[model samples]
Target: MFIEYIAQAPKEHQKYLKKMYQLLKEELPEATEKFSYGMPTFYWKKNVVHFADNTKHLGFYPTPTVITAFKENLTKYKFSKGAVQFPYSEPFDETLIREMVRFRKTELEELQ
Candidate 1:
């Protein structure tokens, strides 16, 4: 289902989506991955992140509070509610992605 989700995206966006998936998977080694809400979702205690390839940007869902915590660094990007949009024209910041996932993992661990 994960592979199918990526494969079904636009060819130009496939690389970005694949890269996002790989980054999250590598960062959260113990997390479980699955197709949830029709996108690739990485779950620790709950859904940690969900990413999708959009028309001209990659959508990152790390929850609203997480997005707000990183808002200062994400000023150049577009965001709303629980989603952040990183345009395909701009390089995806893997470091930011890694940080968000690590933060999510920690947050979840503390809750349990």
Candidate 2:
């Protein structure tokens, strides 16, 4: 049931989701892709990042460290306490997404 919904979003959302998946794969080559809680999640050498799309916007679930680090850069966007809510009309920030991936990777590596 969850997998079906992730696979059956609208066309526009599908495009965005594809873009995000590709970008995450490129940025975090070591990460593995998984469908969890109806969202596309990336698991690196350890857990890294996750994201999902809604009818209105995309939800980026970076760790608290990521949110704190990018708090200043995210000022322009509509972010909740932790997640970054990117509307469909606006383009996704690939650079920032890459940065978060890199940051999480580094954190996980250090912990290990």
Candidate 3:
């Protein structure tokens, strides 16, 4: 999925392409990576995250914990049960993603 998306993505999104891939892998070192429907998804005993660059936006596979933790900050963005739609024409919020990665990591650890 990741490789396919990488190949299909527009040249401008290449910068974010690498960054997003790196962050996901770094955040979930033990995650099993695979492609599904041309999307890159990571699984760590369960689904951790999935992402793809759409024609107009970059989408993050939404997790409830992420939505709850960043509700206030993400109010302006479009979201659904498990999807956050971020515009691809601009920069993504790296800080928020980093925080989410940390928060999810801890949450999963606690469950164990």
Best prediction by TM-score = 1
- Per-residue lDDT tens digits for candidate 1, residues 1-112, read 6778889888888889888888887898888988788778888789989998889999999998788778887887898878999898877999988888777788889996
User: TM-scores of all models?
Assistant: 0.93, 0.87, 0.84
| Residues 1-112, model 3: lDDT tens digits | 4666686789877667778888888878898888765578887756777788777878887478777777777776788766788787778898888787777767777777
Rank candidates, TM-score, best first. Answer: 1, 2, 3
The alpha-carbon lDDT assigned to residue 44 of candidate 3 equals 73
After superposition on all C-alphas, the RMSD of every candidate to the true structure, in Å, is 1.1, 2.4, 1.9
Write down the worst ten-residue block by lDDT for model 1: 97-106
* Backbone clash numbers for all candidates listed: 0, 0, 2
lDDT of 2: 0.79
lDDT comparing candidate 3 with the true structure:
0.77
Task: Kindly list the per-residue Cα lDDT of model 2 for residues 1-112, writing each as its tens digit.
Answer: 3345557888778777778777887888876777666677787765688888788998888878889888998987888666888788888999998888888888998987
